[model samples]
Target chain A: MNPLRWLVGRFPTLALARRNLSRATLRSALAITAVVIGVVAIGAIGTGGEAFKQDQLEAYEGFGGTATVEPDVQFEDGNLTNTELSDGDIDRIRQAAGSATVLPVHEPAGSFVQTQSGTLLFRARVKGLENPGEFYEARNGTMPDNWRRTIVIGARIADQNDLEPGDRLRVNVTDEFDRSFEIAAVLKPQGFSAPLGADRTVFVPASEFESGGYEQAIVRVDTTTGSVDAATQAIEREFNAREQLVRVEQVQEQREQFTEFFGTVNQFLIGVGAISLLVAAVTIANTMLMAAIERESEIGVLRAYGYPKRAVVSLLVAESTILGVVGAAIGAPLALGIGMAINQLLLGDPFAFTAAGLRYVGIGVGFGVVTALVAGLYPAWKAANKRPVEALD
Target chain B: MAPEPNEDDGRWQEAGDHATSETIPTDAIIRGTDVVKEYETGGQIVRALKGVDFGIAPADFVAVVGPSGSGKSTLLNLLGLLDVATSGDVRLRGRDVSTFTDRERTRKRKETIGFVFQSFYLIPTLTALENVEMPRMLDRTPTKTRQRARQLLERVGLGDRLDHYPDELSGGQKQRVAIARSLINDPDIVLADEPTGNLDRDTGDRILELFDELRRDENVAVVTVTHDDYVAEAADRVVTLIDGRIRETESRRANFEEGPDP
Candidate 1:
């Protein structure tokens, strides 16, 4: 006897079994729909949450470096600028750690820039003076040479004060010093910077900062030289013996935190999906149970013809698996569509739906088949055990 | 042990030379020695068959007749291997079949026995040809079960009704399909539990005639359970059962086409 032929021979009975299940079409459809909803929900929520978190991380990447170094131990509200690395300390760190580039920065005193229309208060963060674009580029004009009393205003600040690329403005430095500066350019608003408030800030050269001002040192490590972790550990060991407040940020730390946060949020989505899948499992089980009971006579007839008990069970399981496969096949794309729709509506960005969701769909279908098989166990056994005479009667 | 033949009984000893090659030599086509069957209902145990002894030879058409509660149906189920005897042994073709499991019984039944239920238990969803092919499906017999089923239907005078479902067919047609199904496996014994019980008188007589033709021409053993004497008279031998015991056994040569036998 051909194994293939045997399987084919049994195919008709399976088809008949599916037809028997269709007698209760509404109940079976409800079970399939439950599976569909679970898969779709998981896909949409899980993918959407991941995209949102990535956007959040990307917005913060403009913080000048892959990692930052600060005082390892500092009391809250204490002045970090006084204890952190200064210009000379930054030069030493850069020379000491050959592979890393450290940029020293300071926050100058807050002052008001007055335009023809109004006056707006803006705090200035100072970085190394260079071909100023090397420090922080502007949207319109070039950086001024020789500290020609030129300033690059923020877009919001420029809008508020009606400042332009060639306009001259008065920069009053805590009233101790005052200077008139040319507005070299306007910078696009970088979302929330830690030291500077939202849009109420500006950037200037570091050479102008006086003594006893607050400042920070940002380090960018080259990953090709060595492990970020090894570099951080070496830096900590070198700085540990000194009185200086020296802290380091390993780029790996940020990546790890990103993964941890994403994992936690994805777990939550999976939990929600699992609960719905469990409900789908129950629905599948209930549907199979009802079908098994309703077709008791039909099952008995098959058994009388010498069909094995295993075959009866297989038929029921196969029908449920087919339904689940069909549902998941349709639901997967629906889930992607839902994710795209949500991304566009909520974040103003279209997201990608990956094929990784196939793993989840396969799990859902497998669960449906096993649940149906388990549910039909007792009924299938009863049908197989029925005495032919009793069944006929 | 073979029991001595009673006087005046056609023992097959003197007429042994009449045995044709087509006739199955059933020294014990169906043999039950002191068989017993008990049924428990509502906490009361009722004995349905009580220490009964009987054997049906191959090519012999026999009838078991009794009142409704006299265990005729129970005896039919036992012979068909659909039910087990509580005590004693049943040997089919000299093999002790009493100890067989349900699966084994199904196998043996498919190999050598067939059944026709009084209710015409054709699968309601299947057409007449499909219904007839159902029994043959058990053996995986090649050569197109569907075509053989069609031939069976044609033989039963329902060639045009092959596609009709059980519900669509008349009562007579359904019984004919049931008869066709019983012959599909070409079993040695056809155990029919009141084949004509649900039909009108004329149809019932026609079905009996069909049974007679199958027994004489195909050389198949037939055990029919019926409550009507007219139906019993159509058989070559009749055994009367009362309260689950064999009360009497009688032999009559059925001159069926000519007239009723004495």
Candidate 2:
């Protein structure tokens, strides 16, 4: 006995539906293919987005639990002033910080870099910091604890210019103040919280800046320095006691906002994928309607032979539902394979499957089956409601 | 079955109540009282059947014969309970089927009547055995429906072709499968419409023999509507219809002229 026939032996309605769909092999297969495509569209895109988000979050691993302190500028007589924090304020910040590494940043300057193309085709942002070791990791060379003159280049800048440690870079701070500095290290690529506050930036010693107040200060807090909450509170109390003179922006709040934004973006991508399934639903409905029209005489015989209207409806709906289940069963694994391929291509790991991302497969399968059932509803009702008199006539 | 004349002549007319519903035998399995069926097409009321009475009793082989458009098909639809008359009443096994709701009519039809079509409309994808099992598919009685379907097929001389699909079977075999299907529910009456119109005379004779066996062994009544005189000659009763009316009922079997069954 055929397995389908054996399974549906007691339920002839199901057996009839199975046989009917099988008779129109090409049409049924095409409908199933549409469902499969819809499922893969949703699943693969969702999983790929999840992998991308995971890689980004990993980049920000150590960037959290830190805060930045910047002077709140005040305009006096339409002239902006009070832009930088004074040395006296730095001393007070150190006293209130309680072992948190507070590195003062100087004003950033832009200059052209000599590229391997024999021209200054690239620009680099030169940011001065009292200590670069608190924010960045060295990919090639070492970051000296007390370096006063050496500069560290970002990974992207090093890649673009074929520069490494021990390379010399000529810079002109002023018309007459021309100097040379050695490339001490090539730093690893940073995430959203870059040390110099931008991609492809270069960092030098704060002593390079001539006679200037601090532009901003980044306070790194961990278990060693106490909770981030306590650090932010202490700095905020010391700087903004009487008025809002300095702004203390916590990395934790920024991370939360970034997460919310990423979630919205992911939902938008999934919604775009769902439209393909909506189109697939219309195709399935069309297929069922065609089947109904083609089988009018068969339906008439059944109706006339005492098969109730409910049984007729059940048979039609079952045919569409079977298509959905088979399509989803095939599409889900295919989608997962696509997702793994994407991960391997981007993150260098084929098994970098996230729990949230894997759920998209289940979601895709659910949507496939439900969409088919809903699409089949009208066709089933239309076929079942037809009068046996007219159908037989 | 071979187009033989009356084996038992001197058949009674039962109080001369030949073509009207004024008198009915208590053993009658189905009785229609002046049923009138109408249709409105293009806002024009076209009467298909105009006030005609029909009846059947157990083991009776009835043939409703007339030319095309003479309302033979309409009367068959009423007898099968696939439709209701626009006026008058149709009673199936003593119940007024004309007054029944759609669901009730369906249930009554399934239990009381079986249908056989001239074209033998077996589901093309199903094997002969499965086709025979179609009518009993919705039965919740938990019986061995498959085994019963096999037995019915065997009875119709289709035992070796049970696994063949309708398209694979010959016309005679397909009709036999349909016959088995009609008997699946053990219905009280088998309503056949143009049953042999698509078959050769030899095959039609075999189908008539099967009907005769069913009537003799199972006591099941059969009502066949046809324009074939050869088929009409084989029935125990011939109800001639013309112009939406029963022109005459030439019955070979005698019906009681008195009251109900004793």
Candidate 3:
């Protein structure tokens, strides 16, 4: 047959396939549901992992050219213990970091602080910064001087304590030593910083901190003279020269590590999801086999009417392809919606919709159709090879 | 085996004589010579048609009647090209079909033969018109097939039931629709296997009358396989089969016109 005639002949077979599929609606629906679940599993995982990687990159960018120096000790669960940097090390970092501002930081364990009303008390961590103005902006008042007994509190602390710049709060250094300190300022809400959460911390002068050594030092690179990479390398050289076992990391490096980790995790998730799709393939094969068996006499009639074996095979495969396409049509969008909901719940925003994520929708649909076609092969072969006499009987 | 017929018997010659001849007799639409069919069930060979010879002529109504397991359906299947004979040649328009490829055989069946089954095998999902259009669709004739289908249905007295499904029609109506389907492709021969077996006596008579009308008006060869005595009585010729062989051949119509000369 000519190509055009062959193409036209497929119309009736496709129509017959569609009609037969509709005749057995429940079985068709079960097969479609299986494909839907498979597509959704891969799609949602792909989109969710992408959104998480984006959120981490954005958070890292918010730190703004600041590199942190801490003791080379592993911290557990956001808490640092015995991670003290000596004064000599701090002075050396300050000298080596070219044309940059260095701020010493100290965070003691959390202490209990009574509100101005004296009726409520809360446990809060007190962080000491050498130059608080360079790191944080004041939402209400100016930063404290070098040796003053005043403190700058975070927005959450100010809100909970109902304190302004002039309010006096008693600070308890130990069980027997307690002193009243004036609130010099309230810092603006900064969501999260490199080493700690800034929204709920209380900032004080490093001079007023009773600890003899600092916890970490922040180096603010001067973009006018050198880039953050150059300053990081210079600081690393200083630490290497001193034979100190300090770890230096650029914020971008940290972001890349995070992205690589999530990439592996996403691949694993997609692999797990593909297993469900394998089950769906089996479900499609079973459905097609049953349909071929049930329609044995009908197939015989078709053969008697001069339908070739290829036409019969095409008809059965077309039925499965329709199932797969319809399932994907419903599943791809559902996966996106589920991914968005998960993003909003976990990352606090619906940022999961990306171009790459949309591509996953297409990939999921392709996967479904290919799986259905492959699964339909055996049944189609069986249907086509049936002898008309035996099938009619 | 029966002795070969002489020329005075008024039957066409055996298929071997026409091995090099390009032209067939004008009247004979399909002819089967020394055709054999066998089946193997659990390692035992069952010969259904043991060297049966048969021929159908255009514009002739021929009924093949037999008891159960007499190989009447088996001979019909071979003549209709639905099954291949194991030994001898079945010829369509004087050409041996044993040499035809699978595709060519299917195309020949689609273009030259039509069939009506006893159960009225109209596709249930399609309406009467669509059921008749199926063979033309298989032929891949894209133009005016539906119009021809509708006209065939109307000719079969189903003009008012064009859109009715098989399940919605009576047994007689479904059979009429099947007859219309059998004629949709304008084939040279129509093969019916117990076309009236599922109908009442009155309905079966009506269907047989329709077949007679098709043979007279369309001049298409109509062959039926049945055990009904009424069907045999209605045909112009009745060939009786007993135990895989033709036992008797009887002519009912005394005066029949010979078709145009080849």
> What DockQ, between 0 and 1, does each candidate earn?
0.21, 0.42, 0.37
Q: Between 2 and 3, whose TM-score is larger?
A: 2
Backbone clashes in model 1, listed as residue pairs: A70-A247
Q: Tens-digit lDDT track for model 3 on A9-124?
A: 55767777888899889999999999999899888877877776666666667665778887776567899544788888888888888688888888665455666566444546
TM-score, chain B, predicted structure 2: 0.86
lDDT of 2 at A247: 89
Chain B TM-score, structure 1: 0.85
Report lDDT (Cα) of residue A137, candidate 1: 54
TM-score of chain A of each: 0.58, 0.82, 0.72
* TM-scores for every predicted model: 0.69, 0.84, 0.79
Candidate whose TM-score is highest: 2
Sorting all predicted structures by TM-score, with the top scorer first, yields 2, 3, 1
Span of 10 residues, lowest total lDDT, candidate 3 chain A: A170-179
Instruction: For residue B35, give model 2's deviation from the true position in Å.
Output: 1.5
Q: On residues B117-207, what C-alpha lDDT tens digit does candidate 1 reach at each position?
A: 7777677666798788876553444346666778879988899998898889999999999898887766668888888888899888788
Evaluate residue A239 in candidate 1 and report its C-alpha lDDT on the 0 to 100 scale.
Answer: 70
- The number of residue pairs in model 2 that clash at the backbone is 0
Error of 3 at A188 (Å): 11
- Clash tally, candidates in order: 1, 0, 0
* Colliding residue pairs in candidate 2: none
